[model samples]
Each structure stands twice: as C-alpha cells, then as structure tokens.
Target: MVELAETVSDVARSEDRKEFDALVQRYHKQAYNIAYRMAGNHADAEDLTQEAFIRAFRFFGQYRRELPFDSWLYKIMSNVFIDRLRRKPKAMIRSLDQPVVTSEGEAQFDVPDNSAGPEETVLSREMDSRIQAALDTLPEAFRLTVIYADIEGMSYEEIAESTSTNIGTVRSRLHRGRRLLRNKLKSYANQLV
Candidate 1:
C-alpha cells in the first residue's frame, strides 16, 4: 500500500498525463458520495465531483504532502461545494417539458424501480427523506460537520482536520447540529409513534 501511494505520488509530482485520471479512478466515487450528500441529488453530485477534480488538478502543485491525499481532495471538494452554494441563483429557470436523456441515449426518467417493497424499506426511505430535510435546515458549517462526523463516520479529529477547525469546534458543531436536528425531527417522531 505504501509503495502504491509512493508510485502515485511520484506520478502526480511529475505531472504525468495519467495522474489526474488515476486519481479519478481511485477517488471519484468517494468524492461523488460526499457531493451527493451535500447537493442532495445525483446530477448535482456528478457536476460537483467533476468541478472539484478540475480545481484539484489546477492546484495540484500546491498540495501539501503531509496530509492524506483523500483528505486534501475532500477539502478542495468542500470548498468548491461551498463556493457553488454561495454563487447559486435563488431560482433557476428551465423548461420542465424537456425530456431527460442519458449519455447512452436513453430516456433517464424511464428507468424502472425494481427494489423490494418491504415495509422496512418504505419506512427507511421516509425517515431518510425527513432527516435529510432537517439537515438542510442547518447552517453550512454545522451541516457539513454533522455529515462528516456522523454520516461519513469520520472521527472528530478527522472532521476538524477536514474542516480546518480545531477538535473543540468540531465537537461543538456536532453537539449543536444534533440538538437542532433532534428538535426538528421531534414532530416527525411523535407522528411515527
């Protein structure tokens, strides 16, 4: 594993044509998952992941060697995601009548849902949607903190490092974020019972 990392590092440092491509192959899914959680949709997640990689490649020369590369990539992704949120228009204008098409020339919206219809699956999806809505209500810092620490299963130190904050701040954000979420979800819980 160390040798593989060293080889990747050497390749990246030498600015080989395949450096970014190799990175994409290794970390694209991880980046996309983070983006998906942040953006709350597949299309936006794909766009965000692509944009983040572009930015990372552009600034690759300045990347610190001391940090884990994945963490560094995630920092770039988080920054790009935040910038997009800031600059995004309050509303977008698009024709709803347009057909959605995939890269394979297939109608995107025509895909069939073949998943199991178990009672647990239905309840889980409902709960997930409600929780995601509650998460969206948080301030960006708290939201990201909660997602990184709780959903992504990152340690407190990792969350702090990823967010460029101290561990105490990470703990504070998680505590406050969870409190807010619990309060927001209380009504839904009552209904469930």
Candidate 2:
C-alpha cells in the first residue's frame, strides 16, 4: 500500500480534493470518535469533526512529513474542539418538566430513560455513563491528555506533539487525570454499595 505521507504530499502539491477525501475516508471514524469523546454528544462531535477536516484541508501545505499525519490531524481537531468551547457561551440549564411555548404549541423536553434495557446492558451503560461523567469533570488540559493517552492509545511522544507540549507535561497531566478518575469512580462504586 502507498504510504499516507505520499498521499498527503500528493494533496499538498496538487491540491487534489480526491486525495484529501481518501485521507478523510481513512481517518474519519477515528476522528469522529475523538470528537465524540471530547464533545460529549453526537451533534457537537459531528460539527467538530467537520470543522477539523475543513481546517486540515485548508492548511495541508504546511503539514510536515517528518511527523505522522494522524498526530497532526489530531492537533488540528483538538484546537478546533478547544476553540469551539472557548467561543460557546455557558448554556442555560432548564428543567425537563418545564414547558416551552413554541409556534405550534407548548412542549416539554423528552428525556430518554435507558433503564428498561437488559440487566447486563443497563449495568454496562451505567458504568460507561459514570466514567464519561468523571471525564467531563476534568479540566480541558487534563481531559485531553487522558483522552489521547488512555482512550485513544496514543504514545506519549505523539500526545506531546499533538498537544504542543513537552512529554513531561503530558505525563503529569495523564497521571493527575487518572488519579482524579480513579477517585471519582471509587466514590461512585461506594455510593452504589
């Protein structure tokens, strides 16, 4: 198989949309997974992934071949995710029981109850939700570090490059993040018992 760097070079030199699309096809699912973990929802994850690819396409010429393409792409995605968070205003919290007046009529938020699933499935989902909630409580820097290292299984060097930080910082953040997650999960386990 042809190397991805060669494909990147082809796109960079020729501005070939086809080559870029191939690259996108190869990495889209992984990118979306990262975005979903970062954004905490499907809609925001989709938007983040789209924006990241758009930016990557716009700046393909500047990509250095010495580094891996996925790491570079991830860097761009992380920046886009962080930028979106910075720009978005804090959302106003509303009760699900409260009714909203719409053009047609009044409507209340319909929250899904996943408690009706099979016992094992419900337990698995509950654990996943608890873990995600713990991740959400982390600061962005630590959260990104944990996601890249633990969730994505990226190497320390790759994470350092992706986050534009030294390996020491990545290690520190990962350690602290994992510690926080352990504590939170332990607390949740205790509550359940």
Candidate 3:
C-alpha cells in the first residue's frame, strides 16, 4: 500500500489523468462500500460515490500528500453523505436478496446451514431487518461511527483519522452507538423467537 500510495501521490502531483484513473480504480469499490453503508441502497450509494470522486479530483491539488488517501477520500464521502442527508432524509428499505458488493464478489446474508428450514430463514431475515432498523434510528455521527468501526472493520485509529476526530471521540461515539443499538435490538429480541 505504501508503494501504491507513493505512485498515486506522484501521479497526482504530476496531474496525469491516467495516474488518477489508476488511483480511482484502486479505491472506487471501497468508496462505494462506504457510500453504500451510509446511503443504505445501491442507487444512492453509486451517486454518492461518483460525487465523492468528482470532488476528490476537483480538489486533488489541495489534498495533503502526508495524509492517507483513503482517509482523505472518506472525509470527502462523509461530508457528501451528510449534505445529502440534510437535503433529504429518507428511510432505507433494503431487499432481503440485495447482494452486498465486496472485493471477493457479491455476497448476501445467509444461513450457515444449507439445510436450514424455512422457519430458520424467516427468522434470520427478521433479525437482520430489525438490526438494520435499529441502526437507521441512530444519529448520523453514531451511525457512521458504528458502520466504520464494526461493519467496515476499520480500526478505531483509522476511524478517527477518517472522521477527522481524536481517538477519544471515536471511542466515545462507538460506545454510545453500540449501547443505543443494543437497547433498540432488545425490544425486538422476543419477536425473533
């Protein structure tokens, strides 16, 4: 990644379109994933990701080379998402079959046991729905914190850098976010049974 970053930095400094394209190719999928988590749907996620790249390109000259590119991109994406939310906040209703796009390929939430009964499938879906709903209820700060820390598997320090906040703030937000999620999910625990 260090070599890749250095190459990207060099290309970006030279203002070469091809080099920029390489940078985009390297990070677009991850950007889309972050946007997908924030937007909660593919269409909006695509739009947000595109907008983030456009903004990143437009402001590439202003980007500090010392900072991690992904962190810088994530900051742009986070701001884009926040602006969109302010303009129009909408509920996310994801289909059960929606394939989550990942580097490995598309994946979906599934029962571990292939022979799982219909009842088990239904229960799994319900649980997933409940958890998503609970997540949706959180404030953007808390939601993004949880998404970055847990869903995206980013470390607390990475999250802090991406969010432009100190590690202490990141930890606090994560703790508060998880507590809220736990409380929200507890209410639906009996329904899953």
Candidate 4:
C-alpha cells in the first residue's frame, strides 16, 4: 500500500481525484464517527462529514505534511461542525397541546413512546442518553476536547493540532469536561437510585 503521505503528495501535486478518493475511503468511517458525536444525529452527521471532506479537498494545498493527515482532516471537520452550530438557530420548544400549522391544514404531532423496551435495554439506553446529554452541556471547546480524547482516542498532541490549541489547553479542557460529566452522571445516578 502506498503511504498516506505519498498519496497526499500525489493529490496535492496533481489535484488527483483518485488519490483523494482513496484517502476519503481510508478515513470515512472515522470521520463520520467524529461527525456523529459532534452533531448528535445521523442526518446532520452525514452532512457535516460530507462538508468536511469537500472543504478538505478544496483546501488540500494548504495542508502541511508535517502534521498527521488525520489530525488535519479532523481540524477541518471540527471547524465545519462549529460553523454549522453557529449558523443554526436556537431550537424552539413547542407545546404538545399546540397544533402545528401546515399548508393543507393543522396537524397534531405524534410523539413516540421509547420507554417500551426491555428493562436492561431501557437502562442501557437511558445511560447512554444521560452521558450524551452531559457531553452536550459542555462548551464547544471542552466538548470537542472530550470527544476527541476519550471517544475518538486521539492523543493530546493530536487533539492540540486538531483544535488549533496548545497541549496544555487540550489537557485543561479534557480535565474540566470529564469533571463536569462525572458530576452530572453522579446526579443522574442518584436520581435513578
């Protein structure tokens, strides 16, 4: 197999779509996983992943080979996710009693009950939800740090490069994020008990 750096050089030198496609094939799943964690939904994750790759291709000339390709790619992904978040409007809360207006007529929202699963499955899902909720509560920097370090298993140096921050900043954010999550999860456990 050609080394990743060589493939990147090929693409960079000639704007080779084939080499870039090969790079995408190699990193697609990892990139999507990061996107899903960042976006918190499948649809948005897919869009974010696609946008990141598109931007990466467009800006491939700016990429420095000294940095790891994955880290550089993740930096692009993070920027895209953050940019989308900034542009997104705050979510509006709607009362269940209120009827939704449609072009044809007024319509009632159908809310599904997700609590009908087996006890073990329900508990597991609830735990995952609580963890995700805790993660969501964090500031974007801390959240991304936690996700990159813990969930994606990126090293401190890699995370620093990805986030465009120093290693000390990454360490601080990870520590603070983990502390907040621990406190939040402890409270949730108490509620369950």
Best model per lDDT: 2
Model 2, range 41-72, lDDT digits (tens) per residue? 67777999999999998887777768777988
Summarize candidate 3's per-residue lDDT along 1-193 as a digit string, tens digits.
9999998878767765565688799999888867776765577778989999999988877878787788889888778877776676576655555788899999985533322467645446557666766777778888888999876798998888878889999999999999998897786667745
Q: What tens digits encode model 4's per-residue C-alpha lDDT throughout 1-193?
A: 5799888777667755666788899999889877877766577778999999999998877777686678889999888978886686644444444788999999986544433356635345546556766676677788889999987888998889888889999989999999988887785666554
lDDT, each prediction: 0.75, 0.79, 0.78, 0.78
Model 2 CA lDDT for position 183: 88
In the order shown, the candidates' Cα RMSDs to the true structure are 8.7, 7.0, 10.4, 7.3
The sequence of per-residue lDDT tens digits that candidate 1 reaches over residues 1-193 is 9999898878776774366678789999778777766775576778889999989988876777676779888788778877885676533422223467778784523323233466536355556656766776777788888888766799998888788889999999999999998998897776544
Q: After superposition, how far is residue 60 of candidate 3 from its true place, in Å?
A: 1.1
Give the TM-score of each candidate.
0.70, 0.72, 0.67, 0.70
Better of 1 and 3 by lDDT: 3
* Clashing pairs counted in every model: 0, 0, 0, 0
TM-score of 4: 0.70
> What residue pairs clash in candidate 4, if any at all?
none
Better of 1 and 2 by TM-score: 2
- Scored by lDDT, model 2 comes in at 0.79
lDDT of 4 at 110: 55
